[model samples]
Target: MAFDGIVVASLASELKHKLLNGRISKIAQPEADELLLTVKSTECQYRLSISADASLPLVYLTSKNKPSPMTAPNFCMLLRKHISGGRIVDIWQPGLERIIHFTIEHLDELGDLCRKDLIVEIMGKHSNIIFCNDQGKIIDSIKHVSAQMSSVREVLPGREYFIPDTMQKVDPLTVTSEEFAAHLTGKPMPLAKAIYTSFTGISPVTAEEICSLAGMDSSVPAQEYSADILLHLYTQFEIYLSAIKEDTFSPGIYFDGKEPKEFSALPLSHFVNYTRVEYDSVSEVLETYYSTRSLITRIRQKSVDLRHVVQTGLERNRKKYDLQLRQLKDTENREKFKVYGELINTYGYNLEEGAKTLECLNYYTNEMVSIPMDPLKTPQENSQRYFAKYNKQKRTFEALSVLCKETLDEITYLESIQTALDIALTEDDLAEIKEELTNSGYIRRKYTKKKVKIKNKPLHYISSDGYHMYVGKNNLQNEELTFHFAVGNDWWFHAKQAPGSHVIVKTHGDELPDRTFEEAARLAAYYSSMRGSDKVEIDYVEKKQVKKPNGGKPGFVVYYTNYSMVIDSDISNIEELE
Candidate 1:
């Protein structure tokens, strides 16, 4: 995520190799704050996209082309007037700052060859694309920063073009150990923060990496480190800068679970615990990382309403289940009341009229029992009162037993929907989930009354033994996969006693291999609510053994016989059909 100076340096190196001495064939402004230059090199055409957006400033070489407006913006026309058909004589990065300078030579109106600098500054919020003359005087910029906007610097025509020294940061490429150590003499911030703020182009991620290489903690204060430790850290810092100076960049992205977390031009050692994906070019890393991150983010935002619906259903059902359990506990002593009534009726024949209490032998546990009678009533009347209490409690217990089971089933079904939401990747996947909620009455259908199109299909995979396996994304899909898609002998797998995906492996009447059994178990574990657990107990049985009871929920099934296995939830090696 840190589009820092080292990335700019790597980009400069790549651009120099691809665009240096190349001719600009076309220029277009597809966006107000963006420019695309089509450059023809030795045998290939590279589209260099430059964006100076206030939110996301970017510069990268892309193969994808964008359609431009029929009319070019004023800034684009100015750039074309100056550098159209220009040959890129040089491309360089200043020190380790987040800037790229493209020195272009083209014929002027006077038939004389002239050089102009197209400088792109990728500073966040202040990033701009400035066109300057050979004399370092700014002609114009994609964005204007006037005195009213900032007192630090003003970007305008006829003004000298210079990178603002607002931070007074030293160049990491040339800083000596003394300069590095002296700058952080009294800084109270963390060691990693002090390093990045004191030097240009070194991101906090890389700073933490330097500290890790030096066997120190980045969270520790800078002033807490000994002189030797500081010197060791400076040495590690030099190694990173040296690599950058040598144009040795290992661009990669680190993932937190299945989502991309951070990316950089250099290897991030501090993120060793995360999943790292490497690429050969900085542009590839940036493009892939941001696109995947954006797509996932977009899907999550789209699933918010559906998640809210599922979460609300889950919460309501859980509360009802808890209350039912409590009421059911109150009925646990109802059997004892029934025994009391029988004992009273048997011993009442020996009791005098209006007796206060009677002691009698209880046959249920071979122990003596005491029965208290209402003095105003006859002993038989007291026995009748006990019988009335017993019958009421017994009825309540019977009724609550069925009601509690339904509540718990609703809870499990809602939990399965929540798991489905987490596994959703595409909009179509979300649409299926939402449709299920609507049909189940948890969510109200929209007024448009559109036709229900079943676009989201169950996930299909090929096991190592060449067996076909399918996993349901939601409960409705689970029913369809198990009942409609699978045959009687197909193997059905699910996490034991947990809400999970219903996995079906088509056997085709052929004896299944041991590998296929394990693979199906793994899928069952991976798609369950216990997906994060190291090992999940899985229940596997033939589809014919699984029965859908009358009036059961969509995914609910009963099976008296099954085989079990414990498997890890790793599906990385499983081949999935898109």
Candidate 2:
């Protein structure tokens, strides 16, 4: 993610090695702010992709080719006219900055030998690809930056092309030890911040790595360090720069769980526990990191609508359940009303004509009690009215009890869907969840003659003891995995009283080892709503003991007894099968 100066330096070295004497065979603009050049080397053909995209500026060698428009853009046509058949003379980075300069020699329109430079600046929003003559006079750029748009420098035709030093950062490659110490001590920022802010091409991640290598706290202010500590920090910084200087780059991507977290030109020793997959080519690392990261982001955005539906349903059901409980509590006094009716009937014979009240000794509690009387009605009539009121309340209580349970079940179901969405990694996984919602009436089903089949399957993992474990990704998957796929001898595992994936471990008619049991519990806890908790209680029972209630919701199961264990949700060590 930190495409800093070191990465640019490494990329420049690679391009120089591959394209130094290569001829530009073709020039194509596949996007508004991108160029794909086919370079013909003596050994092989390479596609050099250069992008000045405001969001994702990149320059890399790619094997993939993109479709171009029928008419080329002005910049692409200009490059074709000047350097289409030009030989790449040199490729270099500018003093550890995130910039690459490609020098080319070719015949001009006037049949005279000329040289031009194609410069790519990977400066985030300010990134640009500018074509310039040997004198550093810009001919044109992929993006035009007028004086009004940027006062620092203009990237228009005929303007002087230069890298603006607005940050006043010293180049790490040439910085002396004295200057390094002075910059660190003078800055009023954290150690890592000071390091990155004082040096060109050093990102915050790299700064942290430097601090980590020096065994210093990156959060501490740089000025707070002692003189000796500052010297030690500088030593570590030199060691880091030495790797880039010696061209001993270890290009790789770091992964947390299954997600790509970071990439570096050199091994990030700071990420000690993360899985680092080394690559021979830095271009491969960049491409893999960006594509995978973009996919994850895209999937999250796609699931937002489904998440909103689940959230809204959960909110409505939860509110209704609270109200139902209150109404049900009101009916708790229905038995007292029935007793009032009985006491009134028992004392009705001794009542005087048109009596206003009746006093009685209630046998229920052996206590004297008085019942209110309607002046115009007989005692028998009054008793009948009380009985009617009791009957109405008793009916309401019965209906509300059923409604409360149903609403509660609905909330749990929606929550399970939410958890499934969190666990979803692909489109088919989402399709299964959407189908479940449609069947359960949370979403409207689209009418179609042909039903689309979903190919999403449960997550399969192998325990340390070599036992195979399956985890359901959604409610429907959980049902399918538990009842049809699993055997009676297999073991079922889930997070206790929580919405999660159903994990079924195949025992294969042999007793499961304790290690396998704990691993299964970890998997169950990891895919549940309590995944963030330090420890989650898990329930594991034989598949035979778990039963689906008649007409119950998918994935809804009950068991009389089960073995319980509390485990952490760290399944990073667990081996997952594709």
Q: Which prediction has the highest TM-score against the true structure?
A: 2
Q: How many clashes (backbone N, Cα, C below 3 Å) per candidate?
A: 0, 0
Question: In model 2, how large is the Cα lDDT of residue 12?
Answer: 91
lDDT of 2 at 58: 89
lDDT of 1 at 457: 84
Candidate 1 Cα deviation (angstroms), residue 124:
3.0
Which digits, one per residue and each the tens of the lDDT, describe model 2 over residues 1-578?
66799999989988888898999999999999999999999999999999989899988889899999999999999999999999999999989999999999999878999899999999999999999999999999999999999999999999999899999999998888889999988989899999999999999999999999999999999788888889899989999989888988889999865688999998789896577889989899888888898988998999999999899999999999999999999999898779889998888888887888778988999999887888789889989988998999999999999999889999998999999998999999889999999999989989999989998889999999999999999999999999999999999999999999999999999999999999999999989998857789999999999999987999999999899999988787899998
* Regions of model 1 farther than 4 Å from truth: 166-168, 181-185, 222-226, 255-258, 269-275, 339-382, 445-452, 464-467, 488-490, 506-520, 542-544, 563-567
Worst 10 residues of 1 by lDDT: 266-275
lDDT per residue for candidate 1 within 1-578, as digits (tens), equals: 66899899989998999899999999999999999999999879999999999888999888889999999999999989989999999999999899999999999999899999999999989999999999999999999889899898889998899888998999988888888898876678888889889989878787888888888888888788778888988888888678787888888888754678898888777775566878888888878887898899899999998988889888899989999999999988888778888888887888887678878999888998887778888877888888888899999999999999889889888888898898887888898888888888998888776876767788899999899999998888899998898999999999999888999999899999999999899899988888757789999999999999899888889999999999888776678877
**TM-score for each model:** 0.87, 0.88
Candidate 1 residue 71 C-alpha distance from true site, Å: 4.0
